[model samples]
Target: MTESWWRDAVIYQIYPRSFADANGDGIGDLPGVRTRLPYLRDLGVDAVWLSPFYLSPQADAGYDVADYRTVDPIFGTVEDARGLVADAHDLGLRVIVDLVPNHSSDQHAWFRQALAEGPGSPLRERYHFRDGRGAEGELPPNDWPSIFGGPAWTRVPDGQWYLHLFAPEQPDFNWDHPAVADEFRTILRFWLDLGVDGFRVDVAHGLVKEAGLPSLGRATEWHLLDVGESPCFDRDGVHDIYRSWRAVLDEYPGERIAVAEAWAPTLDRVADYVRPDELHQAFNFSYLATGWDVESQRTMIDASLDAMGRVGAPATWTLSNHDVVRHTTRLLQRNEGDVAGRKPVEVDPVAGLRRARAASLLLLALPGSAYLYQGEELGLPEVIDLPPEVRQDPAFHRATGQDGYRDGCRVPLPWSGATAPYGFGPDGGPSWLPQPASWAHLSVEAQEGVPGSTLSMYREALALRHKTLTEADSLCWVDTAEGILTFTRGAGFTCTVNMTDRPIEIPHPGVLLIGSGPFDATGDSVTLPPDTTAWWSN
Candidate 1:
C-alpha cells in the first residue's frame, strides 16, 4: 500500500452494535469484529472504518462519547479494541475509527463536573453555557432546534442552558476553549499509539459556531445543514481545528488520514475541510443525495471532482450509512429524503435492487475512494416496519413524526441460519433491532458463492478495482445516447451505465470484464440492458 492508499481505496464501514456478536448478548463487540477480519479481507476492501464504540449511554447509538479512550463495557474492553486493530493490521487492512469531537455524552466526566460545579466552573467553559432569555430566565437561550428534534438548548436546575446540536444527551463542545482542542489532540494520540491508521471525524464541519449564539428565527429544519446560515454548524473556523489535527497525524509513521463527515452547502466549501494542510477527504454527500437521473448524477460528479481536485484532495463517495435509509430502498423512488415517520410508499423490490447494483458499479468505477455501509453488500433494504415499542433511536422519541428515526438501517447483520437471530449471536439471542423474516435469504451464507448475487458482484468489482482502476489517474467522457453515461479510465478501461428505458449498445468496444446486470456483445458493440452498468477493458 502507498502513503496515500486512501486516494482510491474501497473502505467498508462496520456498525459495531449490528455487525456480529461473539457474546450471546445480542449486540456486536470488538472481539466479534476481530473474528471477522478474514471476511473483510476476502471481500477485497483496503480498509475498515469502525463506527463509535466508545463508552456511552447508547444515546444516539454511541455517537455520544462519554470517554474517548475507554471502550464501552457492552462493546468490549480496551484489550478487545487493541486486539481488533492488531488483527486487522495482520490482515493487511487499515483501521479507521470514529472520532466525535463535536459533542460528548452528557455522562462524560467533564459534563458531570460542569453540572455539579454550576455556571461559574472552568469545566462549564468547555461547553456552551448561558443564561436564558425570558423575564424569569425560563426560556432557552436560543431558538435553535436539535438535529434529532425539539430544542437544541437544555436548561439545568440552576437556570443556565447548555447547547446540544444533536440530542440533549450529547452536549456540543466549545471549540473556542483551548482545553477542549488540546484534549482532542491527546485523544488522537491515544489511538495512534495503538497502531490504528486513521480517524473518521464525525460531524467534521460542526466544531465551531458563529460568534453570537443567536436565534435561527424560523422553525429549524434538519436538512439545513449545508445552508451555511446556521450559527452552530459548518462555520469557517472549523478548518483550524483540522489543520492542528493534521499536524498530529503527520507525526505518525504511516500516512494516517482523516475523512470528514462534512455537509457544507457547496462543493467548494466542503473542499475547505480537505485543503492541503487540513483533513484528507470529505464525503461527497451531494452525490449521495442526488436522485437517480443522468443529469443530476453527472452534474454532482463533475462538481465534486472539480472542487476536490482543486484542493489536491481525493473525493470520497458513499451510498449508505447507519443514519439513513439504505440506497436500495432510496433509489426506488424519484425523491431523496429520510424515510422515517412517513407512510410506506410502494416500490418494486426487484427494480430497486437492480438500480442499487447498477449504482454500486458506477460509483466504484469513479476515480476516488468509496465507502460501503455494513449489510449493503447483501442487497439489504431498510426495515421500515420496525414496531414502535422496540425502536430505540433518539430521533423517533424526540420528534412527533418520522423525519429523524434511523433504526430501520441498523438491524443486526445475518451471518447464517434461517431463523430470527440468523447467527448474529452465539446462542441466536434476540437482536437489539429485529431482523425482517425476509433477511433469511440475504444472510452472508445465503449469498456467499452465488454467482449473480449482490455479494458476489461487490467482491468481484472491488477486486477488479484494486487491480485495474486504482492506478488510473484520469477519465474522459464519451458521448452516449440520452440517459446513458460512458467514460473511459486510462486508455484501456471503459465504464458505461444505461439509465434509459431500453437496452442500448455500449459505445466503446472492449472485452467485457464485469457488469451489474446482463449484457450482450458482438464484434463491434455491446448491448447493455436498461438500468445496468458495465465495465470493459480494451
Candidate 2:
C-alpha cells in the first residue's frame, strides 16, 4: 500500500438547499454555505463536494441543470461560486462540483433547441432520439423502469422520442453523438478552468447508452433500467466517455479525482469505471444499502474490494448519503420491526449514535475513501413519516413508494430546533423542510459536551481516522468472527469493532489510539463492551 491524498481524504457532501439559509427565505443559498465554511473546516474534512447549484427551475432540485455555467438565482450568482471556491481553498479544503453529463434540464438551451429542431438536428442529437421507440415515442424503447418511475423514454411534442433514465425533465444525452461528448467536454473544462478541483459525476456509469438499445428481458410492468436489460447507460464504451474526461483531467496536476456515481449490480463492470484512465472511484453502493446481516456485509465488502483491487483505483465506501435512509434509521428499522405493522424504526433515534460509531469504524477501516454526508457525523436519524406534501426530492416523487428512494436521507440540518429556523436559515424564518422538534436536543451545540453523544463520538472517530490518513492505499484485511469486524489498515494499523451488545474478545493489539466507550482489546484478548469500537496505530 502507498500513500494517496484521495484515498486518505474525507469528502463531505453538502446538499446546499438543506444545509443552511442565509437569506430570510426558506431555501439555503451559497451565502449560507459561505457562513458555514468555518463549521466545515472545524469538522476537518479534506474536501467539500457541493451538489448542483447551477441555474435551474428546481424541478429536480438542481439536478436538472438549465445552465451549467451560471448559478441559480435561488442559490446565488457566478461570483458567489467564485467566492465559495476561494473561501473553501482558504480553509484548506478542496472543492468538487457535480458533473451531470448524462442529461440536462428541458429548459436548457440545448433541450430547447432540440424541441425547436426536429430529429437529426445538431442539438437534437445531444439527446437520445430513437424513432418508433415508445407509445408514439411516449413509451420507452424497453421495459426498463426509470429510477424515478415510468418508462425511460418520452415523446417530444414534435412526434420524436428522447430518453431520460431518471426524470422526464432530465433527458438523457446521446453520448454516442460526438457533438454530445463535445458539449460535456466543454462543460467539464468550463468548471475546471473556473478552479474547481474535479467533479462528482452524476450517474457516471450511465453515460453511454447501449448501442443496441435492447428491450427488457421481461415484458411486464415499468421500464427495465431498474431491473437491468436496458443497458443504455453503463454500457460498453462508457470508459470512452470517461477516458475523454480523464484526458482532460490529466492536463492538470494535483491528482484531481472524479468520483463516479456508479450504481450497478456486478462488481466487474463497476470496476471498469475506476480504471486509471477513467474515473478515480465509483460509489460502492452495495455496502451502502446492504442488509445488515454480517455475512451479507462481509461478502459485499470483500467482493467490492476484490473487484477494485484488480483495477487501478481504490474502492470507496459510504454508509449513507443524500439518496439513502440514514444508516441509523435503517439499522433501527431492522432491529426493531413492527410498529403497528409499519415498523418501529421510525422513532428510535436515540440508540443510533453508538451503533453508528461502531459502523463508522467498520467502514473507515475498509479500503478507499470514506464519504461523510452532511449530518451523518451527528448520527442523524431519518425523519419519520416525512409527509409527501413537503417532499422535495424528485426521486421520491417519481418512485411514489416503489422503492425507498432518497427522501429519507435528506432533511434540514438541525442547527437548533428551539432557534427560529432550527439554525438553518436567516432570522430563523422558515426551513425548506420542516425542522423536527427533537432537533432541539440533538443539535451540534447540544451534543458537544454530552458524553456518549453521537456528535462527539463521530468527531472523535474522525480525529482518530486522521492518524491513519497516510494509509489510504492500504489493503483491507478483514476478520469477521466472534461478533466483531476486525481489520488492519496497512501493516502498522489494526482496528476492530464489537457490534454485539455483549463484550467480545480481540485477536491482537498494538496501541489503543481510539475506541468507543467500554472497550478493551488488550494483549491477545480483551472485551469490547456492548456498542463499542477501537482503533490502533502501531
Candidate 3:
C-alpha cells in the first residue's frame, strides 16, 4: 500500500467482545484477533479498527476506559495486543485501536484521585467538577442531557458535581486543563510505541465544550445521529486538540493516522476534522443515514464528495457499525412508519438481505475509504429479539430517546455449529449475547462456498474493486432512469444500483464485471431486477 493508503482503504471494525474468543471464556481477546489476522487479510481490508479493549468496568461497553495503557483482563494482557499488531503487520494489514478521549471510567486512577482528594484538590480540576445551581446547590450545573439519557452531571459526596455526557460512571475530562492534554500525549506515545498503525478517536467532536456550561434552555432528547449544534459537541476548540494530535502522529513513521467518529451538523462541518493538518478521515454518517432511494443516495454522495473535496481529503463511507442497527435490518425498515414512535418495526429478512448486498456493492465502488463492521460481510441481520435479561447495552437501561437496542447489532458472529453460541467460544461454552438458532444458515461455514451468498458476494466485490479501480479520485454520475443511480469511477469502472420495485431495462453500459443478483442481458440493453446493484467495465 502507498503512504496515503488510507485515501481509499477498506477498514474493518472489530468489536472485540463479539469478534472471537481465544480463551474458552466466552469473551473475545487480542489473541483471538491475532488468530484471525490471516482471515482479515484474505478478506481484502487494508486495515482493522478495533473498538476499545482498554481497562474498563464494562459500563458503556468499554467506552468508559479506566486505563489507557493497560489491556482489560477480559481481553488478555498487553503482550497480546503487541502480538496482534505484529501478526497483523506480518499479513500486510494495519491496526487502528479505539481511543476514548472524551471521558474516562469512574474507576480510572485520575477520576478516583479526584474523588478522594475532595472539592479543592488540583486533581479535581482535571475533570469538570463544578458547583450546582439553586439556593442549596441541589440541581445540576446545567440542563444538558446525556446522550445516553438523563442529566449529564452527577453529584459527588463533597457537594460538587462532575460532568459525564453519557453515563455517570464515565466522567468527562476538562480539556481546558493542561494536565489532560499532557496526559493524552503520553498515552498516544505509549500506543505508537506498541506498533499500532493508527487510532480511532471515539466521540472526536466532543472533547471541547462551550465555556460557562450554559443551559440548553429547552428539553431535548438526544439521538445517536443528532445533527443539531450543542454547546457540548462539535465545538471549534476541538480542532486544536486534533491538530496537536496530528503532530504526535506525524512524529511516528508509516503514515500513522487517526479517524474521527464525529457527528457534526453537516458534511462540510465533518470535513473540518479531516483537514490536512487534523485527523486523516471522518465517518460520513449522512450517507449512512440516507434512505434507500436514488435521490437521497445521490444527493448525499454528491454532498459528501463535495464537502471532503473542499478540504482535499478523501471521503469515507460506512453503512453499519456496532452502535446502530445493522444495515440488513435497517434498509428493510426504512419505509416503516414513524421510527420516532419507537414502534417495533417488522423486518422482512429476505428483502433486507437483497438491499444489503446491493448496498455493499455501492459502498465498495465509491471512490474513497469504506468501513465494514465485523459481521457485515456475512450479511448478519440485527438480532432484535434478544431477551431483556441478557441485553447489555447501557442505553437500554437508560431508556434513552434513541432505540437503545444496539445489542441487536453486536450479537456474536456465527462461525459454525447449529446451536446457540454457534462456535463463538469453546465447545459447550456460552456466548455473552445469544445468537439466533436460525443463524445456523448464516454461519461463515455455511456461506463459505455457497454461490450467490452474501459472504461470497462481498469477497468477490472487494477483490474486483482492488484489481480494477485506479487511484484516480474522479466520479461522474451517468444519466439513468428515476429509480436507478449510475456513476463511473475513473475510466473503465461503472456502478449502478436499482432502487425500484420492478425490473428496469436500460442500455447496456459495458461488459458486466459483477452484480448483486442475477440479471438478463440482450444485445443492447440489460434487465436489472428490483433492488440490485451491478458493476461493469466500460
Best by TM-score: 3
- Give per-model TM-scores: 0.97, 0.90, 0.98
Better of 1 and 2 by TM-score: 1
Candidate 3 lDDT score relative to the true structure = 0.89
Deviation (Å) of 165 in candidate 3: 0.5
What's the lDDT for all of these models? 0.86, 0.74, 0.89
Clash numbers, per candidate: 2, 13, 0
Q: What is the per-residue lDDT of model 2 for residues 1-538, given as tens digits with 9 covering 90 to 100?
A: 1225786577899999888888868888889899999888777778899999999988778898999989998898988898999999888888889978888998999899878878778888778777755445554556665767667777777777777877889988877778877778888888887788889998877777666677767644332123343466567778878888899987876767788887665888789998878888888776665655456676788888789889866778887776666777765566432111122145445556667667776776676778988888776777767787887666555644444345556677877656645778767676777767767777777776677676766666677677664544465656656677666766688777666767766656677777766554456767677666787776
Model 3 lDDT-worst window of ten: 335-344
lDDT of 1 by residue, 1-538 (tens): 5868889888999999999998989899898898888999999999999999999999888999999999999999989989998899888999999999999999999999999999799999999999999898899988988777788889899999999988899999999999999999999999999888999999988889888887888875564233345787889899888989999999999899999999887899899999999999898888887767788888888888999999999888888887767888877766534322133355688888899999999999999999999999999988888888988888788866435547888899999989988989889779888998988999999998999899999999998888887545587788877878888888789888888768876555588889898766666666788889988898
Cα error of candidate 3 at position 311, Å? 0.7
Q: Write down the worst ten-residue block by lDDT for model 1.
A: 336-345
lDDT of 3 by residue, 221-272 (tens): 7767773799999999999999999999999999999999999998889999
The segments of candidate 2 whose C-alpha lies over 4 angstroms from its true place after superposition are 1-3, 133-141, 220-229, 335-347, 417-420, 449-451, 472-481, 490-492, 505-511, 519-525
Best by lDDT: 3
